[model samples]
Target: MNQAIDAIRTFNRFFTRHVGAIDARFLDTDANLPEARLLFEIARLGPVLANVLQAELGLDRGYLSRMIARFEERGWVARDRLDSDARARPIRLTQAGQAAFEEIDGRQRDAVAHDLESLSATERDDLVQALTRARLLLDRQAPDAFTIRDARVGEVSQVAARQSVLYAESHSWGHGLEVVEAETTAAFLRNSDAERERCWVADLGGVMAGAVFLTDEGEGTARLRLLHVEPFARRRGIGDALVAGCLDFAREKGYRQVVLWTHTVLEAARRIYARNGFECIDTQVHHTFGEPVQGETWRVLL
Candidate 1:
């Protein structure tokens, strides 16, 4: 643990130095790093409440107030009292502040691009992947880091292809699972009812981290299908969120119960089902996916 902590600290020091974070002026801007960031946030979320910025940035209230006052004095920001609540005020960036933010943003981008230009293409790719993994690990702990929304156009095929690749590699399911996924996903898209059936994708910072679908099974029953989380994105409560989303949709649609089928080897998914009140109602030996395995049917009352 000590070694790990030391390693992380070393990396932090190196990274801060690499990015010129120790300098008072960030990217040759008049404002320091924190001040520049505050300006950027104001530009991005203008008409946003000051307390909202304080909570979002984890800044001390007095410190943020002072910073805002400074910006106001510079004629870069303006704050207006809320009509409904006089105590609450919303902050906005003036034209001068927007220009400042744009300059900082452009310089930051150029700095990053120049640094990346020093590395080979392969090294740059590795750096991006490493950064993605780091972000996924760090952001997983935040409750609002992942969001569940309806799948967009062409996303169904993406989900099916991802599931096919993951299952084939991890479970030795071969091409049969891929064929099934394509067929099932295509059918769902072709005949889906917007009000009664739904497909949800869990996005983490614009990446599709997980997905699940609740389809009408007729007879007042809903079928929960294709609950999948990317291998790197597991153990992040995404599976739980997807399951909860399915169940909530089922309840909203007035379904009497939900059912799902899964193989015995999918222990993580099975655990999620069990925790969500699904009971394994039946098990049978099956060779559906190029292997002899125990198939289980689970059900939950809505």
Candidate 2:
């Protein structure tokens, strides 16, 4: 326990120093760290309740009230009482506040770029994986505790990256997997049909825990693509939920049937597909990922 505490403290100290290197004075914009924090938080989740903000950041109520008042005085924020609860008020960034946030955000990005500009691609990947593991451990998020939502801009590539990393680590799949996933994902976005297809991501604690894509395959048939969940985030019914969501969307889109291709080795996913009414229609051995694997095609009548 002492060693774990010491390790955590060491990381905390290192992070503090890292931020100090980034900008100790909030990029010299007259705002201290706390104020900068408040500004950025408000900017992202503005129109958010003060109590919610305080709770999310673990800020003292009194301290948060003071900082909010300061922002209001600077014409950077405004608060409006909630109709449901008079004591509850939501804070929002004013136009001036938004401009300030943009400036601060831009500066922060530039500072980060300048700070880590020397790292190679491999080093950056290492750092990101380290950070992801740290977050997954520290947040202690439950496997099923995730929100299924529409895949947003720039997240498709992230989905590909997540799949790449996980597959490489777990299955020893080569770069070919990432290449196919990336190309298919990009094409999914480029040629998305609003009425016929959809993409859903399992957003676990703001991280991409899993993702599933449904694409139109013409002839009243829809194809389910890229169905996967992070290993750490498995077994919480996320996979089932994602598959169900895709099926529901397909039904809503008037598809007569749905089909999916899966590797036989993916037992968990196979179970999910089976539970969701899919039946294996065909199978073939392929050396797609530089190894011979049995791939199965499953189909279900909608």
Candidate 3:
């Protein structure tokens, strides 16, 4: 523990001193850190909605409004109304602001890269690899950002049809996947919501890619069921996102833990759950789904 604490402190000191983040530039000028950060964000994601910036940065509406006003006074930014929403406004960096931001951006990157280059090539590669691994691990452990929204009417039928087709092809288990008609799924979806059972469908580019549901498990716990990502979206991290979203919703609804039951044949899902801190607590032989399969129960404390 002492070694770990020391390593973290050393890294923090190194980052602050050598990273040349926007905060450092604030000191060089008389400007403050918040303003500098706002400028940088605008330069990077300008033509972005104001509300998006507020959520992403966790800035107060009043503070952001004042900052934008300041930028506008200096002709450093411009605001335009969103076409889809008349009341919504998006900000963009003006020509002068873009040029100024570009110069600062180059300096910031160069400073960080130069410090990193102080290390040997082999050392740099190893450090990058370690950081990448740490990020992947952190993402698995962290709370998911996806929110639980109301599923549109009849969304379950679409998801079930998608899931049935997938299971039929992927698992040798049985025609059971083909046997469970859409009516069963439609009933489940219609009865579930944010309060009782959480159900969600992932929509990208205005199309539903996947869906998952967590029904009441009794005793302050919930069971994650019906995790299905469409074939086209299977490898795109959608499954992990769905699982994380379900767990997050479970926590929000005052659950103490979340559990899942799945066949051992689904190695990918198992790994995702395990990485997110789920542990197998039970197993059994099941003849359901028309296949003799070994089912495992996994759980994670909220």
| Best-fitting candidate, scored by TM-score | 1
What is every candidate's alpha-carbon RMSD to the true fold?
A: 8.4, 9.0, 17.4
> Model 2, residue 169: displacement in angstroms?
1.3
Give the CA lDDT, 0 to 100, for residue 259 in model 3. 89
* Candidate 2 regions with alpha-carbon error over 4 angstroms: 1-10, 15-133, 138-144
lDDT of 2 at 89: 78
**How many residue pairs of model 2 clash at the backbone?**
0
TM-score (C-alpha, index-matched) for candidate 2: 0.59
Q: Which stretches of candidate 3 lie over 4 Å from their true place?
A: 1-149, 178-187
Prediction 2 global C-alpha lDDT: 0.85
Task: Score each candidate by Cα lDDT.
Answer: 0.88, 0.85, 0.74
Q: Is candidate 1 or candidate 2 better by TM-score?
A: 1
Higher-scoring candidate on lDDT, 1 or 3: 1
Separately for all candidates shown, the number of backbone clashes (residues 3 or more apart, or on different chains) is: 0, 0, 0
Per-residue CA lDDT of model 2 for 1-302, tens digit only, reads 99999999998989877776455467777577788888998988879998889887899999999998888899999888987889877899999899888888888799888866889976776676677767776655533367899987777778888888888887898888889898998898889887787889997766677899999999999999998898767767889999999999999989999999999998888999999999999999988788888999999999
Candidate 3 per-residue lDDT over residues 1-302, each given as its tens digit: 99988998898788665543446455364345677678788877878888888887899999999988988888888988877889877899999778767766676577668868899986786577566445544444433233335567767676777777778778753456555546557657556555768678876433466788788868998988778765544556778888888888788889999988887889888988887889999999877687588999999998
Candidate order by decreasing TM-score: 1, 2, 3
**Alpha carbon lDDT of residue 213, candidate 2?**
91
